[model samples]
Target: MEEEHKFIIRTYSKAELAHLYNPDMPLVSAMRKLRQWIRRNKQLSSALAEAGENKRDHSYPPLQVRLITRYLGEP
Candidate 1:
């Protein structure tokens, strides 16, 4: 039998999530990098848009966060 750990999904501000992905980088730089990653990922971008996500929004809803984690793998 294989054990599968479930990841908890939650809302996160863009900066917070970005920092989780890049702890060593400055917050602003991490944010920029996170934005680039999202922008460059077509599927994630469209999914976010379809879920009513605004590019300028400061936070991600739980659903959007899940989508991001799915594509980018837990950051």
Candidate 2:
């Protein structure tokens, strides 16, 4: 009798998730864009931030928000 091997998939890290979602894009560039967007759209950013800070089950703001906020001052 031959023994069969089973393979298990592992979850991605934060960096891995980012790269997988946006391949070929520099991490820094992606973050910058996200921040910029957040700065421009304060309401959205605030909502998302609140959700996260409060530990609510809500999706995060788009990556553009993170990128935009990083480069530009928050609104």
Candidate 3:
């Protein structure tokens, strides 16, 4: 019998995240701003640091998701 594995994977791409952040803004511009915001926010930076490089460079972890939702308004 094969082993079974289950887990929830949560990640948003640049385009998706951009749209989530601001639908009215241009995609490239929004993405740039989002990156800057992630780097500038203390709570977000710390969360990213704790989550490590994988979660930092690639996608937002669960903690970051909560923070983003709280701060950025339901992204």
TM-score of each: 0.87, 0.37, 0.62
The candidate, 2 or 3, that scores higher on TM-score is 3
**lDDT for each of the candidates?**
0.91, 0.45, 0.65
**Reference-based lDDT, residue 58, model 2:** 27
lDDT of 1 by residue, 16-46 (tens): 9899889999999999999999999999999
| Candidate 2 residue lDDT tens string, 1-75 | 999654223333334434444467797665455445545777756654654532242233445334323444332
From the highest lDDT down, the ranking of the candidates is: 1, 3, 2
Which run of 10 residues does model 3 get worst, by summed lDDT? 5-14
Better of 1 and 2 by lDDT: 1
Best by lDDT: 1
**TM-score for candidate 1, residues paired by index:** 0.87
Off by over 4 Å in 1: 1-7
What lDDT does model 1 reach? 0.91
Q: How would you encode candidate 3's per-residue C-alpha lDDT over 1-75 as one tens digit per residue?
A: 999644223566656776667778888888888878877878766766675635335556566566666655665
